[model samples]
Target: MNLARRALLEAGKLLVVLWLVSVLVFLALRLTPGDPAVLLLGPQAGRPDAAETLAQLRIEMGLDQPWIVQYGIWLGAMLTGDFGESARSGVSVTTLIVDALPPTLWLIALAVVISVPVSILAGTWAAYRGRGWFPNMVRFTSTMGVAIPAVWLGLVLIIVFAVNLSWFPSGGYVAPTEDPVGFLRHMVLPVATLSVFLSGILTRFVFAEATDVFRQDYMRTALAMGLPTRRRVFAYAARNAVLPMITIVGVQIGALIGGAVLVEAVFGLGGLGQLLLSSVLNRDYLVVQSAVLLTTVAVLLIGYVADIVYRLVDPRIAR
Candidate 1:
């Protein structure tokens, strides 16, 4: 039950989970309906020679070969920093991802920053304030947040903030390079959209965790020692409560990336979410598969980081 062995075993298991997810995602995208070549090149419009173009596309994507061979080639190329070309744009999938990843990362980073601490604090407060009308109200709101769809929320924000108030851009990205102020203005809506959704879930977990910690023997001992409510609750209960909340948030990271597709499309923000949607629409298997794998890797990485930090906070976690 020592920490080191547990950590190693957990890490290995998480890696296996990630690998399985990647494989399935890759296969699923390829199995979807529609031909990427036709999606990209169109049906005998410019070519006026459907058969010849399809043969060329089959060769380019190795679709002319068996599934296993194609998978090997695709996976091999992927590992070597070669993402292959998009069927539609003839653009390298890796290049497109590089171009698109930053905005999505930035958006997620901002949302996380807002969600985590706020959730922890609010949850702690509610736990300490227990059974009060205010705490009950907060709990109800958190439940709603967990229930409501992020996409629906995004649309609501767009209508209220962008359309009704005559404030913020309803959709689209503004590159910081091209227009810094415009970029920020465009950022506010989507960031708020994501933050609201995340904060709700985090807050609920935090509240539950904090409440559990509040009942622990250590909290009673701290109070018996004449520690102030704030000090005892925060330094004792809050500290212990954070671990589970952290774990949940880490798990949610991957799912949020998937969730962002809807949010980004609703907001018209150009990020991996939007990119994933477009790739799906075009039936661009490589791009879609790559994006899903990338997102899954991110989730695993974050969860692993949380596990590492868990050991630091709760040294007994290893046992």
Candidate 2:
């Protein structure tokens, strides 16, 4: 019952957040300098008929209405699965998002797969090995991970792996459907770029939590009871350490989305981040709004799943 109530509350909160995000996205675009109408009309913007053209464009795009009315119209159409047309391309905004989503999703998935296990093992080893060169190395790596900018790291990797060694493609993504081997080859550099940074952050979280868990009375009791060293450490200490890690993972979801923007730019991947960047630059309001909302929805869904995962990991959380 408590879990159900919590889920209900979370759902309600998510809805409220999404609504607020939509409002903010609308206003942010509208409040920015430069008129979308003027940008749309381009070279004709300074002609004798420019004002008339702008007025017609505003009316056609429903931008002549009050902000509230415009938002209402947008929200209503969005509810019906209409994200509106792209101001720049005349293409459907939804179609653009759909096309760009896959590469970003794949990049994120690869990052998680590589980062989580590597961090957990490295952190656990550092915690158990107790005051040694290995632990110092782990700590140093984590510090550097936090310090280095992802874009700089990405550029360096491209220089070494792609430019110098020719071990992987420099940039640009290949669809897995087109050629599986080529897809993996293309993904290697970007995925590794994302994983290294995320793993560095995750390592610190895991090490801290595992160290704390190792100090707890339950872990001490397990040790005293002569439970096999590995079993006791993992089954008891590691399981407890996971609760905090779940929260870290949830937070990382947002970071991954943001990081993907830079990573995509570096690698020339045609993902949602790239699309969002271009749309925002072009002042394509519909595409920008749709992309941001879609990304936010993805973040919220990950958070909701994290909540459920927390309950599963420790049933006491459900209470």
lDDT of each prediction vs. the true structure?
0.82, 0.89
Q: Candidate 1's residue-wise lDDT over 1-319, tens digit each?
A: 7767777888899878977886787688777887776676775735656778777977887778887887788778878977777777779888889888877887888888988988888889999989888799879888887788888888888899899997998988888889999988988988887887788889998898888888888888887889998788788888888876667888888767877777788887789989999988988888887887777777888988887777767767755
lDDT of 2 by residue, 37-141 (tens): 888999999998789889999898888999999999999988999898998989989889999998999999999999998888888878877699999999999
Which stretches of candidate 1 lie above 4 Å from their native place? 45-49, 177-180
Off by over 4 Å in 2: none
Q: Judged by TM-score, which candidate is best?
A: 2
Residue-level error in angstroms, candidate 2, position 294:
1.4
Model 1 Cα displacement at 176 (Å)?
4.0
Q: Estimate each model's TM-score.
A: 0.93, 0.95
State in Å the error of residue 256, model 2: 0.6
Residue 234's C-alpha lDDT in candidate 1? 81
